[model samples]
Target: MTKGRPGENPAERPRAAVMEDVAELAGVSAMTVSRVLNAPEKVRPETRARVLAAVRELDYRPNSAARVLVTGRSGVLGVVCFDTTLYGPASTLFGIEQAARDSDYLVSIASLPALNRRWITRGIDRLRSQSVDGVIVVAPHESAAEGLRNLPPGLPVVDVGGGADLPVPVAAVDQFAGAARATRHLLSLGHRTVWHLSGPPNWIDASGRVAGWRSVLEAEGREIPEPLVGDWTAHSGYEIGKRLAREPGVTAIFVANDHMAMGVLRALRETGRRVPEDVSVVGFDDVPEAAYFWPPLTTVRQNFGEVGRQAFQLLLDRIAGMEGEARRMVEPELVVRESTGVSP
Candidate 1:
């Protein structure tokens, strides 16, 4: 027996000894010992028990880094996101993390700043250097599409909402369709015409929504009024709402997102306009708080969790050399609430 070090318990030894000695005593290979540690269910119960007993006897602890080096698989996936604080991107990240954990994989996130070309390029380069098995990019801005043009070939990527035209596999909620549905619902309520509050024009989703709202109204032969723009914020929505409140003959409105709709609600209330009474409102992105709005909100629901799950799976498939269409679109659902009603 090895003597203990000075002021240390002489009986204890480093954990690495346990792993090596266990493999030797159990008459198994080191790779077998690793499999037993990393994937217990894959090893036969009898062999696994023997490894466990030897491990206990030798006090062995396997090193994860060594295992990763030998296997060439870190079991990690990298996610690049823009606007980490945004409701949709944040929720998608949570979903991706949870799904990765469930699949016995690790997720690492890198938040891109403002979805600019330089930020996206640098983020992707950083993730590549980390040896991530694949990458999922939450590219909600138009600049992301431009960035995609510069990505190195054959790097597995799944884009979320970069644009309608994608060079790699993509998973996105159908913003255009959702916006059209919201507009149609308001029109069906007997509103002569509907006004729009749009998000920042540079975002792909915002552009799709704006186009959808415009196309629907134009198809119905309704007069299309100039849409007010917001920065996907409640404050911007409120500002636009204030302007709408002062305008005459504005009976119905569709705001780009629920957060902004909250601002619209505040403005309408301050201006003495009752929702669904003097004015009706509908919004996109049925965020959790939408239901709790004063009169509740009528909005479009984008299933961001589903988007993340599908995007990750698509990336994995791509990494495995699977071939399929590069773009995929998810449909959104229109949620009806108390905020919209028949026009007077």
Candidate 2:
């Protein structure tokens, strides 16, 4: 009977004491007792019950810190993200959080200022201090991918969107396919050519969408014009739309995201360009407001939620040393609405 320190009773020394007692009473090793606590499925049912009963009798509570020390896993996932206010990133994070909750894992979010290497490295180091099991990065910029290349070896990582080349798994929406679909849909409505208003060139999603749009036009032998670029903002879209409204031979337009499309809509209305009649419009990322736009926007709906879930799942798989491809792409769907009409 060893005496505990001040303020500690020998009967209730701590979780370690209780676990040791349980192991002795159940005639099992301490490692076996720990296995039963952490992964009950690994232990035989009868043995598991015996250990559990012993735990109850001794009033034993498992020590999470001790478990982490033994397993070298914190059971926590770190998420590094940017654009927290944006629809795509926010929705995706929600899905990831939900999935993590379902799996009994905790998430710690580190919002990076930008996708620069310094910021990303800092975020990673911060998460590492917490001893997270793995990390999920949710920036979809070219710079983000470049930053990921600098990470140390053997750390499991999952990329949500950033076109950044990743060492671990990567999950994202198929922006190119979605853009192609949008373009083809416009052409089908008898528009000779569909103009494009792109997001910042640095974003991987923006680049993919632009590529898809160009590929469709080039395949049909339609003349491709210089794409108007915006900064993924409604105001930028509006500015580009104003200029586009005055451009000769422009009848249909494909904007990169819904927010910009709203701005385009405003510009079109102010310029007296009747939507779907004089000029049809299609946008990407069917945001909540896309439906409520004066005329519902015909836009591509990206599966951001699915991206988040898949990103987390992929990271978990990598952490568990499962065999699978490191890259995954989610497909986006085109939603037809009042914004597009048959060419007169």
Candidate 3:
């Protein structure tokens, strides 16, 4: 036996708690605790609650090493995505971690600085080396989604914000509908013609928003102006906004995200153009800061939390050998704020 540390009293001290201790405290068998931890759906709600309560009270955590040795499985999920500093991707990552925790699993994450076929493969490989049961990729850009198509066979995978008609399962926001709604709302406010500032062409979300905006303009018989393109940044928006501010006929503009909207607002202010008075501005991804923007921002709200949870569920289902139509789309909502008003 390993020698105990100095001053340690192994004989008098209670041993670290085990699953059996938790089961006894909850008045259930050890197998029940196992089921609750592994296949919670199989256990009745009441029993699962009781076991979980006991687990919490006892501060019980399964012995991952022993469990892995016996089961040849790691009770962990991997989340692979780009930077988490951006609001949307960050929120999705948070949601995925929360969902994994609630389901009694740990999460390993690989955040790439830039996404490419080689980097994505390396990230997946890193997680695979750790034996994560499955992975969820937040592949908004085309390149990231393309890398996913070449993943090794038998790896359970899901994607959040994947490209259109992706072969793998995906959970994404209905960007098209949300964009249409935002544009339609502006048209309802009597904007004769609405201009758009689109996100980068490489992102599916960006393309979907552009398509939706285009469809609305076409339907209303309005002439479409060339949309300004942004790399989904405030700086890009500022540059585009400066040009639009110089145009007297540009009365209404829809930006692809709130970050860009802020830039546009600033650019308009600098150019002596008034929001709602001279030009009505709308943005997408009703981020937390949207409501706090100067004059606030009317925008589309994609429930990234829900999308992440759905991706987690889909991945889990695949890991359990169930598959088909795992692609799920969460609808986006248009939130009205002070930034948009009767088009001048």
lDDT of each: 0.86, 0.87, 0.89
Clashing pairs in 2: 139-162, 140-162, 145-164
Instruction: Write out the backbone clash pairs for model 3.
Output: none
> Which runs of model 1 end up more than 4 angstroms from their true locations?
1-13, 16-19, 34-45, 55-62
Write the residue-wise lDDT of candidate 3 on 157-246 in tens digits.
888998766768999999899999999999999999889999998888999999999999999999999988999899999999999999
Best by TM-score: 1
Which digits, one per residue and each the tens of the lDDT, describe model 2 over residues 240-319?
Answer: 99999887578999999999999999998899888978899999999977888978999999988899999988988988
| Range of the 10 consecutive residues with the lowest summed lDDT in candidate 1 | 2-11
Q: After superposition, how far is residue 100 of candidate 3 from its true place, in Å?
A: 1.2
RMSD values for the candidates in order, in angstroms, are 3.2, 3.6, 4.9
Clashing residue pairs in all predictions, respectively, total: 3, 3, 0
Comparing 1 and 3 by TM-score, which wins? 1
Estimate the overall C-alpha local distance difference test score of candidate 2: 0.87
